[model samples]
Target: MPRRCATRNDLMKPGYVYIMTNKNNTTLYVGVTSDLERRVKEHKSKKDPKSFTARYNLNKLVYHEAHQMIGDAIAREKQLKAGNRAKKMALIESINPEWQDLIIGDE
Candidate 1:
């Protein structure tokens, strides 16, 4: 047997489509990223002070789904963004009835 090295293509990471909301759940944001944890942290930290998430204080990750590729995740994000608030809320409620902060593990 021989040792094999990993290539860029071999390091394909799963993409994520995630929803973030404020503490009061008055606002909702849908985004796609390859690194869910990092992206969530960025949201929490307000990496871009003037960004929509920062302005709305939408740091709590309420829902997320993983896809095989970034393109799939982006497509899903678009679909979610195009949807109405009621539909989006329904989608989130389907998995997270209480609309808990998924990143903090407070179910």
Candidate 2:
């Protein structure tokens, strides 16, 4: 569980805790940062040209947890990253059984 900040009413700081899966759904990537839009855009565009995400085609924004503080988001990302692949798949599956690539929940 994440430690609650002493402050309440956390503002949306544009940070995102996100997960990505390979085309065959055999791989997963967990990450967090302050720029959800730009980061997801890069992944979808394969902008890095040679990144782990791009190499694996892990561009689907399958699961995400928005946070007000980067610290909280990072912590959550780390937790998810340390989990087993089955656990990770289950997490995404619970929210999106069809593995819908819900970028920013625009759909």
Best by lDDT: 1
CA lDDT, every prediction? Answer: 0.89, 0.79
Residue 9 shift from truth in candidate 2, angstroms: 16
Provide the clashing-pair count of each candidate structure.
Answer: 0, 0
What range of 10 consecutive residues in model 2 has the weakest lDDT sum? 6-15
Candidate 2 TM-score, true structure as reference: 0.78
Q: List model 1 lDDT by residue over 3-70, tens digit each.
A: 67645663465789999999999999999988999899998998899999999999899999999977
| Colliding residue pairs in candidate 2 | none
RMSD of each: 7.2, 6.7
